[model samples]
Target: MKFENLIMNVGYTDTGYSGIVQVVILRMTHMSMVNYSYLVVDHINNQAVIVDPAWDMRKVEQALENTETVLSGILLTHSHLDHIHLAKPLAEKYRCPIWMSNEEIAYSGYYAPRLEGINITPWSVGQIQIEPLFTPGHTPGSMCYLIGNSLFSGDTLFAEGCGLCFDVQGAYNMFESIEHLKKRITPDTLIFPGHSYGRAPGQKFSQVLKNNIYLQFKNKNDFTAYRLRKGQNKLNFFDFQ
Candidate 1:
């Protein structure tokens, strides 16, 4: 579904799930660097969870009011500034726990009284069952969230591209992480990336595998070279020196 720009700068796209649990996923697009934040709402239970809460709160607030759901938790994909800058404030304002990988807390030292460090185990917020996938590439503690068939990949995996690596190690990790995802992701699984580099937000995983260049690399060395290649450093380059 196309994200229709609403009153605010944010573009909203609502997608519904089926089966024993039914919930709606609202995608907030057009954040800094084309970042996308999401709201997983259980309207029947009046509970909601925010994913990678960043940028302005107006768009997120509007989504809450429209759904009549109260924020129950915040899910972080990683510790990057664009993806996690607002976690503390949003969690405080809504009085909810901020959930992230233990690796992130250790790597970035993200501190908060309400911060909850999670493993690969799956959990639930109301009807929405959240599964954490450890896909560290962009950051040492990078993570991706799996809710039903939707993969909320922060920066690990973009629509047709992947996140830049910090070093040779990060690039290797990203390659392995994506290789793991390929085994789990099915054709129907809708990938909701953290940013839109080239393709749109919600694209089928089948299409992604076919079109994504990063996924084409089976050799870690080649992936690393290309990921850290020249001309991409101005904005995304991370200098280890």
Candidate 2:
């Protein structure tokens, strides 16, 4: 999607200092207009990172300005334009790296000067540390991040839904990814999704498992069937419900 096509701004929220990072939701184009853009900051160091920023560059800058947090870099959950639209410009402006899954790079054909792999030990910007996991679903390069007790789930997971499964293999990987995450992280791990509509922040992961029907599917075939059933139809990114 072209930046000129987007007119909405990113949303912001203060997560307090409970080891949970603050979030900013940047609405994007079409049905994804309700998607969330995230600005996660390290409370102690005031250094921050943005996750799946959509389009509004000014809003991201203002969030960093108001919080006194320096933009460290950008993290991508997938190659979806809505998730990565602002990464290029933001990284260019800050001279920061754009962390992403290499598998997604193949799909996006994204050309950026600072694109870097997100698979490795947890990365740190000041006092905050982020562990990126390869969770392919919704897309071949879908990913998720772990920061302290909070999980910044891009299109992989949501408050009451999981990301759409476009690729069957990728969907299987997503199932495996969430299973691993569930085993490794605590139930209390706060979930900050790529889209939350207008709901409050800090939703728990355990709750999603219980409520997300897509996540409860028995296998990839079942999940695929579900996704096909929920096809976009005539909905634009703005009308996604």
Candidate 3:
């Protein structure tokens, strides 16, 4: 099915991940905490993948129960608190490996300060397949996921805005990542970000290509100047990547 066609309401309760593909977007009413996370289930194999699980572990567990799919693994886009607050607990509860980029694995503690030695690196499990793309910029280890044609862009790419680039290096890296995504991912890919601020849950990769003005900046200097003008006083190097 087309990725846009799969979009659904924010509060998709009682939804199960089955069939060829299933996505349930948990409602995150709180500010800076929108869209708890996404559970992508592949019904063909009865396996599941959890992406950026943020709030209500019970809801996630229940989604798994409803779908009759195993909690195969967790994919983290970055080490941001809201994106990964529930990761360790969920991993412990399901005994599933947590996957992320090698960079995130090494420098995740800045955001997840309480976590020590949490195994965060890329490894696949179950029927859900994930191809990791190193899209640093929102943070040094920020990453995105490619599942089928859907890109689970954790703060890296948003519908109308791009991930916040706080540092010069990060901004530069983000520019590169955006360029890479444009060239590598399919135009039909749907973007599922970590937070949408109560907006719809997904956007086509093509839309971001056409509309994300941050990506339109001719150079990193231009993008950095734009961010500075926006009044971002501090660098958030460890927040997005």
Which residues of candidate 2, in runs, are more than 4 Å off? Answer: 1-32, 197-199, 230-241
Q: Candidate 2, clashing residue pairs?
A: 11-25, 24-37, 25-37, 26-37, 30-237, 30-238, 31-236, 31-237, 31-238, 32-237
Against the true structure, what is each candidate's TM-score? 0.85, 0.80, 0.79
Q: Write the per-residue lDDT of candidate 3 for residues 1-241, one digit (tens) a residue.
A: 1122232322212234333566766543334335448888767678787888876777778788887988777788888777786788887877776776767867665333223232324344444556788898988888788776677888898776677777788888988888888887876777788756323556767777787677688777887788556545443332221
lDDT digits (tens) for residues 1-241 of candidate 1: 3343321211122224343322233444442244678777665588888888777688778878887889999999888787786788888899999999999899998888799999899988876778899999889888888777778898898876888787999999999999889987777777877766555666889999889889899799998999888786565422110
Give the Cα lDDT of each candidate.
0.76, 0.70, 0.69
Q: Name the 10 consecutive residues with the lowest summed lDDT in model 2.
A: 2-11
Query: Tens digits of per-residue lDDT for model 2 on 75-174?
Result: 8888877788888889888899998877788877877899986564676776566777777777877778886676778877777666766566766776
Model 1 misplacement above 4 A: 1-32, 233-241
Candidate with better TM-score, 2 vs 3: 2
Q: Say which prediction, candidate 1 or candidate 3, comes out ahead on lDDT.
A: 1
